[model samples]
Target: MRIELVKGVNLNIIPSKQFKTTRIFISFIKSIESKKELAERALLANYLEMCSQNYPTQIDIARKLSQMYGASFGSSVDRRGNYQLINFSIDYIESKYLVGNEDLLSGVIEFLKEIIFNPLKVGENKNFDEETFTRQKNNTIT
Candidate 1:
């Protein structure tokens, strides 16, 4: 099923019983107009993957994922022809597989929301946390 979350953004739901794991992928696509934008997108993707407002550090993210049965989450940037796509993905064990009635799917969705919409920022300033941003920038450079 495909849902238009907004004017240009879409949500696709593919239900399958074949696998014991559930994978969620969110992609941001934009027309490639300049090399600078591509570079910025790449850097932003890396930075977002590392930290968020709620998950302030890599360790925090790791602990959260560990709590969710070792769910794996990541982001990637790709270019296809004239368009560039930044994809954030997470794979987790289905709720039915858990021992209790834990709603892992809801937790996963909340985590994704935190990563995408609530990024870590410098205090009272409209900028990314400098340490995280600099690390990501250096990693991208090297």
Candidate 2:
């Protein structure tokens, strides 16, 4: 089932008793005016997924995800006609499948929220982390 969480956002929940994992996807869509903008958007997507304000390094993020029963986090950019879409996805084993009755879903959701809403910034300029941005940009270019 899908529900409107706010004015411009929606939450979709699909339940299946036969599946062992749950997946959540959040996406942002906007028109791409030019190639430069598209490139910047793609780089931004990469940077956001790589690190956030709370998780400042790739290893830190990975370790946190590992502690949460090996949940997976990812982001990507896609083109649909004249628009660009940025998607953030999280997947984790269902609580029923985990040992000791742990609640991995809540932790995964919180981490995803942090990744989307609280990104690593450079000093007081409010810009993305320079090191992270440069790394992602170079990786994207090659």
What C-alpha lDDT, on a 0 to 100 scale, does residue 21 get in candidate 1?
89
| TM-score, per-candidate, Cα-based | 0.91, 0.90
lDDT of candidate 2 over 70-109, digit per residue (tens): 8888999999999999999888899887778788766776
Question: Which candidate wins on TM-score?
Answer: 1
Cα-based lDDT at residue 79, candidate 2: 98
Worst 10 residues of 2 by lDDT: 2-11
lDDT for each candidate structure: 0.89, 0.86
Could you give candidate 1's per-residue lDDT for residues 1-142 as a string of tens digits?
Answer: 6655456766676879999888889999899899999999999999999999899999999999999999999999999999999999999988788888577876887798798878998777668999999999999889
